[model samples]
Target chain A: MTERAVCVIGTGLIGGSLMRAAEKAGRAVWGTSASEDTAAEARADGFDVTTDTDDALRRAADADALVVLAVPLPVLPEVLRRVDAVAPEVRLTDAVSVKVAVADAVARYAPRARYVGGHPMAGTSESGWSAGLAELFVDAAWVVAADDGLDLDVWRDVAELAWACGARVVPAAADEHDLAVARVSHLPHLLAAVLAAVGAGGDDALPLALAAGSFADGTRVAGTRPELVLAMCEGNRDALLGAVDDALGRLGAMRGALASTGGLTATVFAGHAGRERWAASRDPKGVKVSLKGRAPLAALRAVGRRGAVVSGWKA
Target chain B: MTERAVCVIGTGLIGGSLMRAAEKAGRAVWGTSASEDTAAEARADGFDVTTDTDDALRRAADADALVVLAVPLPVLPEVLRRVDAVAPEVRLTDAVSVKVAVADAVARYAPRARYVGGHPMAGTSESGWSAGLAELFVDAAWVVAADDGLDLDVWRDVAELAWACGARVVPAAADEHDLAVARVSHLPHLLAAVLAAVGAGGDDALPLALAAGSFADGTRVAGTRPELVLAMCEGNRDALLGAVDDALGRLGAMRGALASTGGLTATVFAGHAGRERWAASRDPKGVKVSLKGRAPLAALRAVGRRGAVVSGWKA
Candidate 1:
């Protein structure tokens, strides 16, 4: 059988990781980088890399070829315009962290192309091609936009690509995806950033120096690129604001309970119970993976677990 | 030189870990558990354990002997009273999360005993004796209360014990330790709890299921024992409240910036810079470790690094 051809634009962390996953899936993969240096690096790394997005899309304009627009949210509209003008026949997808904004951009600028809005739930604080790892998406959930009018074949191919990356595909509408991430992803970033700032507010370095595992783990994400975090938060501003309000209400209630009762009541105990329950409910056995041949460091293991990359679980 | 004898009350996670660390440090250690089952478990696990705290303290009442009170903050006063009546001659210390309250309790009930307040900055979410490890405090900072009127010999002995347990002794006054932990530790706990509660507040399980590494990392502390979290927060009420306000103010400003300017400006960039600077400035070489003999996992390592238990750093 002929392997599927895939093209990824913007060879940053997410895009580069996706290209690596596509290669792992035995697909003919191509990628484009905004910086010539990064493009050269990707080529040196044995990837078909290009400096121009239009030229890259032109190469992927073959029958049934998939074009993944993996740029940041702010640049999505312009890229959509370019794709519409250059290669509207190519089936398109996205890997932006924010979904609704990208979906809107796609509807406005690339209405002629068959598009599937997607977000691969994977990343480290580091960015760019240098930070990309082949095992990044292993056991992670890749969200596919299951909006009305999205072609069934396009959705299936996207799911196949996610599986190729050793990721489980979760189907959600654009709005649902945005809101879910706002609560879980975006809200946590804001909290960590604020916590980091507060820790530094004090003059003596004892607080930071004496910080152990909890503080390190808690503030790790706050060290990510500020511009990227800001863009993701602003792109999903409404959902993020609502999440912040919810969090504030919860914090205020806890403070009130502490003041009035001097202890956490069963009301606050629910958080502990809920978190444990949620943690236990994660089933690593949900994905069925079978290796086609002897693959290097490939596995169906969940993301963040050791040896997950070498587990080599393939659908 | 003969090994320094140490006794630990309340053989839970922290206490059990201390006992294990003391044993590794070549100290003759004894432990007491609140329940017969825990005492039996401790004995079965090769610890010198008993159900009577008073009896255990009486056995360790020799001159220069140290007793570590590792009970929860709410129960600390009662434990101090028992220690005073049974072993007033034993140099007493504690491993509570909050310091000011513990210091106050020691002053009130165990005034005759030479006392020091100590808090080891290490723990996993799991609790009880079963989770104890010999290396739990390795490479971790153990805060020794540097309050006025503390006996010089008592302080030296306590610092010696901290170094024995593969920990770096960080000298901090009661209030300073309380305030620093309030910002870095207690406030983060409240944020995690609220974030967990808010994430679970939504009816859809999708948000909870889709929670990735950042959400999981940020909220890891929320899964800790709720009552313990409450006690820590309430024990350092003033500082935690102040931290809460500071955090809320920072969060509010960020939300307003996103709403008004539609992007993160330099103001928000402080968090990123502060987090990075904090991460980069960590000096693993700050602690100087010297081992008298070959420890089982002996290596020149910083606390929190791999195999820190045998590093055996003395300050």
Candidate 2:
């Protein structure tokens, strides 16, 4: 197989990291930034980058190259338009959060190009080229959203790109990806933002002083670039809103349970069991939450009767 | 001052850690557990523990000793009653989450003892004696709730105990402590629980596989011992409920703001600024969120006028 050339547009944290990962995979990697200063910084950091968007597209117009749109969601349509006009033959992909919108945009503007929508489930509460690390995608889940007319080979290329970055590739449809991420990622980010806002809006600085590991870890993502968070929430508004309602319903049930002694224990136990199972599967290096070996069906039935359901509990 | 002995009434994670910290601080430490198995485990782990509650209280009846009630809130009153009846001469303190309730209980039952309310902000998802570590409380905030009639020496003893464990002692009134922790700690814990429950309750195992660092960190405490989380939430139900309302209101506003292109950015930015300030104040080793060195008043006014009032913004 010939060496694959990878081009990432927008040299921010995700983009810069992808470039570095592609380079580490022995692929020829190039990057483009929205601003001259950012482009210069990326170049200074040993990335082959340019500030000229058109010029960047021209260089990546090769049919064998994978052109990754790494910009935020709101600007994706415009980026797609530019890419389709300048690099129509190149196979396309993205590292954007929301899939449906990107999938739709790619379908409308870049119909000829085989575009695979992807979201790498990895990032820090930091951004810009300076925050990028080559190991950012290690052991992370990279979701590849299937599009209707996309070729199988293009999907395989996206998966290969993710694997090259040490990521586990997860195949999902556009809507399925959105719904799943809304439950796991988007809703949690908004919830963290709300918690941060509440703590920050409290009287005096006592709330801040009392905020410990739980608060720090909970609100960590809320401290990310504000515009970035807003874009993500806005992009996946429908699914996120639905997830918020689902969570609020769960919380309401817990509140009702708290009204009676020992009622809340059922919910807490269910959450513990659920989280332990989920945690065990996701990251072994993370805090190991032990669960006594029990049949999944029995655990599921028990928790289901208790009015809570965990993912792995189901067959 | 003569070396003070410490007696911990429970050999779970918090109690065991307190015992270890006390021992490391050159204090003779003793502990009790409700279960013989747990007591035996504690003993195996080098803890001087007794399964008999009566004998544990009897051994801790020293006038110069500090008796720490490190148990669940549901059984806190019962433990206080036992201590009052068996060890009233001892200076009393507790490692409970809710301060107001514990203070009231101490007043009602252990009035003769020098009772001070202390809450150590430190833990891992794992619990029990085996999970306890001596360094658990290092650099953590230990809130010592102020009482009207508690002796100055008693307060000093609590502070000294926290310092001996390498904790920063934060003096706060009972109601104040409850309110602060409700906004910062309790509310976030429940929110994490809700997120965990939602992820667990999703249709497929895709959400679990796609769960990333944010979800992992956000739900870290959700995997803790179920009964403990229940006790903490139920113990501070009123305050936590109020905080939940506050957070929901903020989330509702953010949801509404998402309808407009730039509206949600205000809330996101406010959250970012608030969390940055809160994070900087809590943990020095934590990531420093730069705020452009502008006057805080201006920053506050800017965000407050934008309709989201972060604590740092509410002058």
Candidate 3:
């Protein structure tokens, strides 16, 4: 099968990396950045990039290429408006961190577009075009939304793009993907923030000096740019709130056990078990779901729910 | 100055590492392990290791060596009892994680011992003699207790040992050290446990599949052995409880803000600032505290409070 051309909007770390990876995988790829400096940097690095959003969308529409919105949540509305104006019915997906927000924005702003939400579970704390790596998505999980009544053709295209970029596809429903990411990604960001703040404790040198591996690992994500963290976390408010409540409940029980009995056996053992479960799931057996089958979305969601990755499509 | 002979109790990761590092620094070193298997393993590796705690203490007494307690908190009192029986007045120190518990144990079991408590802030998740690294303490902070009425001579001896092991000394009171570690070390363990459990969410495969760098890093310490985590966290119950309360409060406030306004700006920014503070203090300026001064303890504590490391000491 011939690879579909990819047009990536907002050429930051994830987008820029995707453009590079997709092109390297033999797909025609071009991208745009809102920042002229970033676009010029990418261009200087021998990639086709521009700062004109409308022109990029027009090219995508003319070629019937897959249009990927890679902008942060705060800028999604404006980007969608341009997509709606130039390519209202284009094959669409995104590399945004949250799915439900992006899907909802698509529904409101670009209703006619054939959109399937996506988030590649990969990144570094660093950002901008200069930080882009063509190998960034290698061996990573790229989540593609599998809600009912979606265009299977566009869905397969998105999964193919993920595969081409060296990532395995994990198909899940939009709302389910949001909740799962809220638990695993968004909640950890908040916890890291809290841990960092508590470790700092008004900039007390003694505590920071005594901090070692655990503290460093626990707070590593807290070093991410604050605005980016706020955008994704606040964008997934409902799901994140549920995750936060769940975390707080567990913490409260842990504190009660510690204060009363001075025993963290339950908490520690449960966590050990949890970590073991994760370790066991790291190399899940591969599965395939036919996109042409009846209830394909259900099959995809089941594959994701079982922690299995779609190694390849069964046409 | 001639290096003092050192006797280490317990041959686990920290203890075994200390034995190797001290010997490399030209100090006469021998160690005892409660587990005969571990003692045999160390002995086979060409080190002076024995399972006979009484004999080791007798030798330490004969050599006027520094008796270093490197056992877990659960086994600390038993070790102290052996110390009292064989070498009640020996120059003593410890590499325990919790300072107050070990100090209290020494006070109860070996009151006449000239003890200056110490804890090297370095380790790996792995345990046992095979996991020990001679370079573990290199460029790490080793906290030595500086409470009022501590024997300055013994304190200097402990600092010298730390220096010889390639660590910089950070002098803090026993209570202060406990509190600081409670915030940085013990509390991070608990938080990691909670985060791991929440991410696992009753062994749901979806969340674990979606987990990425943040979740992995935030729960990295939860991969540690549960019993070890329970021992240190429970041993410092009072201080850990306070830190847990502080974390719970911040999480609660974050949840409130997230739920009510869907804004996490405050939490995100605070955490970013805290991470910046840690980064700024990473390469702290060097300062020296004279052991011969009238208020040397006071000077050491002040240096620690300002996050200044002891580069060297003045006689």
Candidate 4:
């Protein structure tokens, strides 16, 4: 069998990191950099880098295994057009956060794009080539959204990439993927940023100095790439907006219950149990972890005893 | 002057920790335990412990400093009654999370209690005598809320104790303190718990194993003593609710902005800067520190640079 060629478009954090790791796994890797600077950096990091997006398409066409669109949402439509003109016979896919927008774009730009929509829910506050790491996507979720009757072989290859990068592959449709992120991904960032702004609002700003790690951790996502998040929110606005409203309602009810005797009291225990379960579980890649609360770090092994499906904890 | 005798009520995480820290700081420490077992354990940990709240109050009545009502919100009234009847002359205070409730409870039950409301805003997920650590309160905030005309000496003593634990001191009205916490402290726990529950609710339930450090850090406070958190939420229900509403509204705005081209992009940057600062600033606290988006493992000089008060460098 000819060597499996994997072309990754947009060599920033996610793309660059996966390319480095893919090269290590012995895959023939090709990447397109929108700028000469990025192309130089990607080449310096030991991968074939191209400035012409079509060269990437040709290299990834008919003879290859996977073509990953790892660009931002705003540029996806243009890239999809280029891929269509060149790689119509190839197994194609994307690493965009908003699957619905990208999927729609693919339909309009390249109806037979042979592409699947996906989001690797992993990143740091850093960006650019420097943010790339061999284990960047390890143990995170790589949500794969494909239509009916898609090629099973392509799915297998993409899933392998997910597995190789230590990410768990979860299957969802475009809208389903959109909603899940609104809840788990996008909402958290918004809360953190606003609270920080509020905390920083007072005279003397001393209250902020006392804000501590809990404040930072809870608001960690707020500091994510603004352009990226803004793009995501735009692409998945209604679902994300609904989640915000739903969360607010819950927060309001939490307050109402706190005022009543039998109220917030009942909910507190449920929160405790939920947190316990959250802490006991490992990352999707199966690494042991401790959430903010201490779950008797000694008894974490008992998580499996509690019927936790921890992946690497298989005794 | 002779060493001022101080009685620390409750022999759990906060109380026991205070007692140990106080003893090390040269205060004559007397501890009140909720039960005989805890009292015995407190004694074993080298503090003077008593099972009778009234008798201990009577015996320690002549003392200068009194840490009162070593109980959650529900039992505070009774503890105040005992303190009023037995130690009426001593300067009194508490280590509760919600300040207004403690102030109100003391005012209602022990009007002459000479009480100033306090919250150390420092702790770990551990409880009991075994969890006692003299260094726990170091460099944390020892917030004091007292009437303007109240004896500065009294507030000074409490501040001294907080400082002895290596904490910085902040002053506010009891009501203001509660509102501040409701916004920064209480709301985060609820939000984290909400997120945790959402993660826990998935069909495969593998989100638990997929729960990473971020999930753990974010949800850690939710797993805090449910009764304790319930007390805080219950005590400051209105403010906490307001905070929740505000948080949700902001989160919604952020989601909307993420989905659109405009909305609080600078706020997000400021938040990230503020959070990074909080994790990096130094207030010389011995409190267990955590961060949302960053690690709190920098040198002691860099412990808490997250607030707006500290200047942020735009990245």
Candidate 5:
């Protein structure tokens, strides 16, 4: 396979990690960022960084493959416009959290770009050039969401990149990606955030010391940039609404079951069992959590390269 | 500062750990059990074990000392009955979960035992004769629940032991202890158990490999003996019920907040902050989580033992 000039927008945790991963995989990597300072920092970090979307677009215009809109959800449509205007001939993909809105937005703003909506079902609380690590995507999941009209090789190229980045490639439609994320990532973020708010809210002296590992790990994602989570929740509002309701509805029902002291006790145990499964996805060596047992090839996920195995204390 | 004979009924985790702590403290550690086999094991484990409640009664009859009912909550009333019948003149304590039930039952069955319901907020998923660790109560929280009529010295003695074991002593009324455990311990257990059951009962192919550190650590205490938790929930039904309701209520509010996605508003950030403080409680250092910052002391309350810090890279 010929090497491709891959353009990564944002240059933060996800995008920087992808640039680092692609560069590590020997792909010619380039970047753009929302801020000139961030773009300069990426340049300092040794990537060919630019805040000029047109320059980034020009760099990948002749390529058989490229990544556009490798940024936050709110700015995706603008990123798509810039890329499509300059790199309309290139095959395209995105790494957005909620794909439906972005996909719809892309269709409106960049209908000519051979765009395939994609979401790497992974990330960390860390951000920026400093957070980049090459293996961030190892064993993690990347959901590929695209309709049948795109060229077959384009889909293959994106899936291949995900695999090369050590991510498990799962195919889904745009809406399905939104739904799944709302259930898995978005809802959990909200849950953690609210738990933090109410559990420790407004108290002059927060006696949070009683909380153990579970609460911390369970709510870890909440401490990240609140704006990011808000975008995700809002971008995928309908699905997120359904997912939140599902979680609350299920928990409510479980409480009722426990109230009876008997009956189908399966639901109660099921929730814990799911948590047990999610917890086991750690990088055996570094502490990064890998989806489907493969670690991401992204640099950002490698910050906690020496991961915590809480149960590592074997008797 | 006088050594005295203390009878520990139910030679299990709480009883055995207490027996060991007491013996190490140079006190007469006498223990009993409903089963002869366990009593023998307790004796073999270096305790002065006895099945004779009458002998224990004789031993404590003339002293201002400690006697612990380290039995299950459901069985506490009957055990307290036996203690009343044979050792009615002794000062007593217990390591049981449900305070209200045990207190009410003790009032009915062993009014003369000077009983103060206690729960050493310490445990492992493993139970039985071998699960007791010397440092089990060390740097752990010991909830001392008492009514108004109790002797302050008796409370002091129990607090001293917990402190000797490197524990933080927290005073709580019966109802207070019940509610607190429901919030911090019992509710988490039930929730974890329920989640575990769900996972175990589901698609057998759910890779336990994906069950990384977070899920495992979070659910560590979930897989504990079901009967123990059942007894707790059943015994402290009122408080546990209220906690479960509270938990579900929190989950519900969180759900609504997440689904609405009115941006990364202060409401969401509040949750994140609350969780951050709560997650700081886990101190995975030498011998104590509750002993986070405390130096080796004999009778101090561990202030740093409760908060669990979450997210970010480090704890």
Candidate 6:
């Protein structure tokens, strides 16, 4: 099978990295950035990058390339409008942090696009084209939305792209993806922000000075660009609100236990168990699903539900 | 002056590391552990480790060595009683995580001892002597309680001990240190526990599979031994309660904004600013304090309040 050419929109860290990874995987790849300076930088680096989103889409449409939307959440609508105008029937996916939001926006603005939402669970705190790396997605879990009635053809295209970039595919419904990420990703980001603020908000700088590894690790994500964090966090507000509520409930229970009984056995043990569960889930045994098999979507979702990842497709 | 001999009363990670660091710094160091197995292991490693706390304290008294209480919070009272019986007047200090609790315990159990509370702000999740590294305290902050009326002679001994362990001195009042660590250390531990439990508490394991660096870092401290976490967090209940309340307030406000205005602008910006402040405070300009000067305690406290670390003492 001929590899699908990848046309990545918004040549920032994620998009630029995807373009590089796809190219390195022997797929023809090009990208466009909203920032002319970013496009110029990528072009100067010998990548086929441009500021003309419409032109890139036109070429992608002509070549039947896989189009990956890599813009931040706040600009999804504007980018979707352009996708709608230039390549409404293109094979489309996204690298946006939030899936349901992007799915809804695509339904509203680019209804004809064969869109399969995706989020590669990978990145550094750093951003911009300069921080792009071909290996960013290596060994990362890349979520491809397996919502009902999705285009299997486009889904395969996106999955192939992820696999080509050395990521394992974890098929999940768009809503499920949103909720899961809210717990693991979005909530952590918010908590980090709060932790950072609390650590620095003290009258004396003693807290900041005395902060060691826990403080550094717990608040690491707070160093991410505020605008980017705001976009992703606020975009998944509903799911994140639920996650935040769950965390607050736990915190309240913890405080009450500490105040009354002077014991954190429940909280600490529960957390340790949780961390153990996570550790056990790492480097999970690889599972394969034939895309042409009966109930491929069901199989994929079942694998994901069991915390298993599709390392690759089976013949 | 000749280096004071060191007697560490608990040969676990921090205590064992301190013994190694002190010995490496040319101080005569010996240690005791509540666990005979650990003591035996240290003894096998060619260190002077014993399971007899009273014997260790008696020897420390004979040599007029620094008595470093390296036991957990729960066992501190018992250890202090031994100190009262065997070495009540020895130059004393502690390596407890919570200073106020240790100080209060020392006052209650060994009131005649010239005690100076201290905490080396460094550790790993692993415990026992096997995990101890001689370089563990190198470049780490060793906080010595600078509360008023402290024995200047013992204070110098503790400060010099910290320096001998290749750590910089951070002078803070017991109450101030408790509050500061409540915000920076204990609170992060609690938050990490909550985060780990929440991430693992999901009905499906998809969240765990999708977990990335943010989730990993946020919950890293949750992997620490539960007993240790419980002892430190519960030992400093009053201050930790305040920190937990502060975190809950920030989380509540963040949720409210996300739900109402769909904007995390304020929270994100505040967190970003906090992280930036922390980054700015790293590798701060070295400052010196004269241990023999007038109002040295006041000078140390002033330096600590300004987030300046005492890298060394002036003659």
True contacts kept of each: 0.53, 0.60, 0.85, 0.41, 0.34, 0.89
Please name the candidate that would achieve the greatest TM-score relative to the true structure.
3
lDDT of 2 at A275: 86
lDDT (Cα, tens digit) per residue for candidate 6, span B1-315: 559999999888999999999989999998898888998899898899988888888999999999898888888888888888888898899999998888888899999999999999999999889999999998888899998889998998998899888887889999999999999999999999999999999999899999999999999999999988988888899999999999999999887888898889999899989999999888855686687758888888988898988876676
Each model's C-alpha lDDT? 0.77, 0.75, 0.90, 0.67, 0.62, 0.91
Using lDDT as the measure, the top candidate is 6
Off by over 4 Å in 1: A1-3, A266-268, A284-315, B1-3, B266-268, B284-315
- Model 6, range A1-315, lDDT digits (tens) per residue? 459999999888899899899999999999899888998999998899999999999999999999999988878899889989999999999999989889999999999999999999999988999999999999999999998778889988998999999999999988899999999999999899999999999998899999989999999999998878878888888999899999999999988998899888999999999999999988866787787857878878888999888776676
DockQ of each: 0.30, 0.32, 0.86, 0.26, 0.23, 0.88
Q: Which lDDT tens digits does candidate 1 get at residues B104-175?
A: 888798889888888888898788999998899877878777665666566667778888888876767778
In the range B94-192, model 4's lDDT, one tens digit per residue, is 888887677778879888877767788887767777787999887677676644445555665676677667667666666666777776677777777
What are the root-mean-square deviations of the candidates from the true structure over C-alphas? 7.9, 9.6, 1.4, 9.4, 9.1, 1.7
Model 5 TM-score, 2 decimals: 0.79
A164-243 in candidate 3: lDDT tens per residue?
A: 99998998898888899898999999999999999898445889988888888899999999988988899899989889
- Chain A TM-score, structure 4: 0.84
Quote the positional error of residue A121 for candidate 5 in Å.
Answer: 3.2
**How many pairs collide in each candidate, listed in order?**
10, 2, 0, 33, 67, 0
Best-to-worst ranking by lDDT: 6, 3, 1, 2, 4, 5
Write one digit per residue (lDDT tens) for candidate 2, span A12-41: 989999999999999998878889999889
TM-score of 4: 0.83
How far off is model 6, as Cα RMSD?
Answer: 1.7
Candidate 5, residues A28-107, lDDT tens digits: the string is 88888878888888788788988788877887775544764677776776777776678766778888787778878878
Candidate 5 overall lDDT versus native: 0.62
lDDT of 1 by residue, A1-315 (tens): 236799898899999998988897789898888899999999999999988888878887854688998888878888888888999867889899888888788889888888888888899988989899999998887877766666656766777888788887766777877888999899888888888888777766667766777677788888888888888887898888889888777777766776677665654477787687568646633443342333211222122121111222354
Candidates 1 and 6 compared: the better one by lDDT is 6
Q: Which 10 residues in a row give candidate 1 chain B its minimum summed lDDT?
A: B301-310
